[model samples]
Target chain A: MTYCVGMVLDRGIVLMSDTRTNSGVDNISVFRKMFHWAVPGERIISVMTAGNLATTQSVISRLEERSKTPEERSNSLLELPTMFQVAVETGKLLRETVQDTQSENGEQGKGRFTASMIVAGQIKGMEPRLFMIYPEGNFIEASFDTPFFQIGETKYGRPILIRGYDRNMSFEDAVKLLMVSFDSTLKANLSVGLPLDMMVIERDKYEPAHEQRIEATDEYFLSVSSGWSDALRTAFHSLPNFSFGQPGNG
Target chain B: MTYCVGMVLDRGIVLMSDTRTNSGVDNISVFRKMFHWAVPGERIISVMTAGNLATTQSVISRLEERSKTPEERSNSLLELPTMFQVAVETGKLLRETVQDTQSENGEQGKGRFTASMIVAGQIKGMEPRLFMIYPEGNFIEASFDTPFFQIGETKYGRPILIRGYDRNMSFEDAVKLLMVSFDSTLKANLSVGLPLDMMVIERDKYEPAHEQRIEATDEYFLSVSSGWSDALRTAFHSLPNFSFGQPGNG
Candidate 1:
């Protein structure tokens, strides 16, 4: 399992993903799940994947392969006109890769080769965009009403996002919001672990604005984790208690 | 789908459940999911159900039927000597009810007739206990390490419980913790909805210490919901910001 979130904000786009992967509890391993391509001042594309490791790797490899081939250069991330086009091409590649792998593995691999992804970035002139690509290669773009998209182990962290998200918030606040969301998921689920990969693409810059690999022992993350817990406890205690009715009155 | 949680604390137990029941998004209805049987100072047992509605209802019906029948008195909740026995009998009844339903419904019902339950309360002389009963007639008691059990649509609300729960907290605190959990779940899920049923069973007293039906317009719940969002936003703003590395330094 994995947890990746992509947010489209007024100022920019933010992408974050956990590094943990596992076939089973005993076979846990850390793998980077965020991939990015930036042609300075032209375009920037970030892809965060969840679900089957092999299928995602195959899709990424195919995309990289196509980018290097002269004939396929026109369809590559560097040559794509907009983030929407990049998302469409990525979705197609993802679907084909899954189909190929499932065919090779036969009937038993019907659902085993499936994977999903969050693709977010900006083109030189177009607005930054965020999309959640489904296992079947279909996708949905984030809108004002739903400014963020999350894949894999999403429920634990979603409530925080729903309550805290604001389109007009600063990039710093956006990152902080996602940090809390990710921190909540990390605490509630073992499948999602650190270190985390975060990328901020400031709108119109067409280049990565900020990027970091947040390790488990990162001082900032530790502060946020402990701080959030303490804050919650404080907030909980501050809430008005339920006044009991008379005994036997239910 | 449903969301129900039960916690065993030093002061007593707190149980909460949402009233929404749905066959699909278009077919939703309100149904009470929390049931209790108390012999005043003698004993008090609260049962919270989740999963297949029919199976849960059948299990509760069977338990109620046995309690009212003279011949079946020996196996009824009223006659159970310990909360542990009550949990075991409830588990057995749940399993039998599910099996009976599935057999009648045929092969299509194989996975449909499953349900889970949280059985909590105290007997005359035993310590107040909490158990999560599975569909297979097996159950596990909550320990200090795992002081609460939640069934159905549980993930969204779990992070708060992980952060806020304290075994020695006051009964009021316990209810507040659960209200936060339920509020989070309600915000994130369409399957779980308003008009929550809450019960507090204080230690030794056996009878319910407090009970309430929290409507959508309930002032306390409204305050908690809005206050939580405000607190979270304030906490987020107080966190340290992510210091960006040099451009291109990932």
Candidate 2:
């Protein structure tokens, strides 16, 4: 299980992903699931993955391998004409990677592996875009009605997004909302772990405006966790009771 | 899909259930999921069901039918000597109901249908108890570590329970927390709908201490929904930014 979210706001785009992967209860490991590509001022694209780790890693590595070779790197993320094209190329690679890996184990390559990705970024001339790529290599771009996309362990964190999201929200507030959303998910699920990778891209900047890896001991996250708990306690106490039975003296 | 939660606190027991049932996106209907039987001063039992409404309704009707006959009423809910016996009787009825329904459809009687229930209440002389009964008829009582049980569409509302639960919490506080949980589930899933049924049973009392069906137009719930949205937005704005960078004026 995993949790990754991408938001395309007026100010910029925000992407965050947890780093835990588990095959079973006893078989758990930490693996960074975010990959970034940049061509300085020309373009900057970040991809966050969830689902089968092996399939995601293979797809990302194939993209990287293609980028290293001058001939094959033309259609790479760094050279893509637009963010939409970048998402399309990435999804094709993801589907191909899952197929190649599953075929090696004598499996049919259909049911053995399934992975998904969130592609968000800016190009030299196009507007900042966000897309959620499916395992079948198809993708859907975010619209004003749904300015964010979340994949994996999404339910626990969705309410915060639905309630707090605004089309005109500043990038700073968006990141904080995403943190609270991620914070809620991490507290409820063991499959999502820390050293969370986050990136913010200012619209039309064509480069990452801010980026950081949030560790378990980060002071801001610590404050957010304790503050939320305290706020909930306060809110819980403030609500009026049933008041039916003479405000029970017990 | 459905969402029902049961909590056992020091003050008493709290049970809440949504009234919507959905077979698919196009096939949704309103059905009550909470059932109760009271023997006045002797015993009171409330059962909330999720999954396969037909199966659950069958089980409750069977119990209701048994209570109608003098001889059979001896083994019925109203006559259960203890809370534990009440749970066992409910579990047996649930199993039998599923078997009868599935066999008539020419499906395997054991695994063809899935149903989960949260049973909570008290016998006149006993402390309140809460039990979660599974499809296999096996049930587990809530403990200090996990003081509540939620069946159906549970993941969306689980985070609040993971951190907000407290056995020493007052009945008012407990009910508030349960409402927050239910609100979150309602926001994230369309299958869980309005007009929630809630019951409160005070310890040592066999009858319902307080009961109400929260309709969609309830003023308190409306306040909760709007206030929660504002609170989340305010909280999001108060958090620190990436900290490593200046406010990206880019």
TM-score of each: 0.94, 0.90
RMSD per candidate (Å) reads: 2.7, 3.7
- Write candidate 2's Cα lDDT for A1-250 as tens digits: 9999999888889898999999986898889988787777888899999999878887887777754666655447776687778888999998887777777767465587889999988887778889999988999999988899999889888987898888787776777778888999988888888978888888777777887888888877777777777665555555555443332211
lDDT of 1 by residue, A139-172 (tens): 9999988889999999999988998889898877
Q: Which DockQ values do the candidates obtain, in the order shown?
A: 0.54, 0.40
Clashing pairs in 1: none
Q: Write the per-residue lDDT of candidate 1 for residues B144-166, one digit (tens) a residue.
A: 89999999999999999999999
Candidates' chain A TM-scores? 0.93, 0.89
lDDT by residue for model 2 (B164-213), tens: 78888777677677778888899889989998888898887878887888
Off by over 4 Å in 1: A66-75, A103-106, A246-250, B66-75, B246-250
